[model samples]
Target: MDRSEYLVHLGNLEFFHVKTGCCDADLPAQYFCITMFQIIVEGGRNMLKTIHSTVLSADVEDTGLNLAFCFTPECGDYEHEECVNQPNQEETSLDENLLMEEHWRKEESMHI
Candidate 1:
C-alpha cells in the first residue's frame, strides 16, 4: 500500500523540556517530543481494539525509541477543553468551570 493510502496527516507536534529534581550526575535532563497523526484503515468502529494493538506491536525490537499509541474519539459537545493540549491543569479547571456555567445558562435560557 502507498504511504498516502494509510497515513493521513502528521501534526500537533510538541516538545517538552523535562528536568530531573533529584541531583544525579549520571542522569541528565533531556527533551522529549511527541508527534500526533491520523491514519486511515479498514473496518468500522468495532475493530478499533485490534487496530490499536496491531499499531502498537508493529515494532517488536527495542531500538530505544519509546512509543505510545492512543486513539482519542472525536470531541463531543462538552469535551473541547479536555481534547486540546493544555499545559496548565489549574487554569484549565477554572476555564472549564466557567464554560460549563455558561453552557448551563444558555440551556436554562432555552428552557425558559
Candidate 2:
C-alpha cells in the first residue's frame, strides 16, 4: 500500500505558551506521534516509524513527549500561574500532573 500526503496549513493560528511563560504562538497545539521500532536486518538495521499524531483535547496524553499542549489565552492570573509547571505530589496513585512537571523540570534543569 502507498501512503498519501496531506497539508494542514495553520496560517495565522496563535496560542498561549504557558510553558515558556510567554503568549507567543511558537508551539501550537499540534501533535505528531511516531511509534518507532528498530530491527536488525541482514547486516543492517531499520526503524519502523509509525506516526500516530493526535490533536490534544481539553485533556492530556501520556506519550512521554510534549508534542501536544494546550493553547488558550489566560483567563486570569491564577490560571496562568497554574499553567506553569508545578512540583510533583508524592503518592502511589497515577499522577499525570507530577509526571509532566517532573519531565519539564528535568529537561529544563539539564539544559541549565
Candidate 3:
C-alpha cells in the first residue's frame, strides 16, 4: 500500500485515512466494519484509534476499502467528543502542519 500524503479533517479535527484489505472470499465485506484501528505516529511514539468506518466498497468481494477515520483523545467509547480543549495532549491535537510534515518526512524516507 502507498503512503497517504493527505490528512482528512472533520470540522476542527484532523484524521488519517487508513486502508483495509478486502475479504479473501466467502463473505460480504459490508457485513464487517472497522471498529478499532492502531495508528502509529512519529515512528510509534503515539498510538491512535479510529473514530468511524467509511466503506468504499459496496458488499463487493476482493475490493479495497479506504476508511476515513479520526483519532480522538479518548478511545473504546464511540460517544466521546471528537476533540477536547486540552493544550497538552499531542495525540489528539494533530494539527494540519504536523500531519503534513510527517507525511513529507515519510515520503522522503521512502524516497517517493
Candidate 4:
C-alpha cells in the first residue's frame, strides 16, 4: 500500500481529510450522523498506527441520522488494482494549490 490522501466533505463541511501512508478507506456511515465517533478497524496485515476521525456539530446533537453515505477515497497507485481496497472506494486527490485554497476555505468555515 502506498501513500494516499483524501478530502471527505459533507456538503460545505469536511469530516475526514488527511494523508495516510498505508491506503485504506471503508468508513461506515455511522461515523458522521453524530458529533462523535468511536471507530474500530480490524484484520489489517499492517496494523493502523495513526487513525484520525472527527465529527462536527451544528447545534448540539441535532440528529443521529448520519448523512455520510457519500465517500471518496484517494489512492496514489492509480495503475495498481484496488485503489482504496474497498468495493465502494474511489480514487481522488487535491493538488497543492487546491489544497492551499481548501486550507483557507476550511479555516474560514471554522470561524463562521
Using lDDT, give the best candidate's number. 3
Deviation of model 2 at 77, angstroms = 17
**lDDT per residue as tens, model 2, 41-64:** 444753223222221222223433
TM-score of 4: 0.20
* Candidate with better lDDT, 1 vs 4: 4
Q: TM-score for each prediction?
A: 0.19, 0.18, 0.23, 0.20
Q: Please list the residue runs of candidate 2 whose C-alpha ends up more than 4 Å from where it truly belongs after superposition.
A: 1-94
Ranking of models by lDDT = 3, 4, 2, 1
Q: Write the per-residue lDDT of candidate 1 for residues 15-44, one digit (tens) a residue.
A: 211111211223232111112333334565
Clash pairs of candidate 2?
Answer: none
Query: How many residue pairs clash in all the candidates, one count each?
Result: 0, 0, 0, 1
Candidate 3 backbone clash number: 0
Worst 10 residues of 3 by lDDT: 1-10
- Stretches of candidate 4 off by over 4 Å are 1-84, 100-112
lDDT of 4 by residue, 1-112 (tens): 3343444433422234544321123322222222211234567543222244333222213344333323344423232455345696543432333454557779989999
In terms of lDDT, which candidate is stronger, 3 or 4? 3
Off by over 4 Å in 1: 1-26, 46-79, 84-112
Q: Which model is ahead, 2 or 4, in terms of TM-score?
A: 4
Q: Which window of 10 residues has the lowest lDDT sum in candidate 1?
A: 47-56
What is the lDDT, from 0 to 100, of the residue 46 in candidate 1? 17
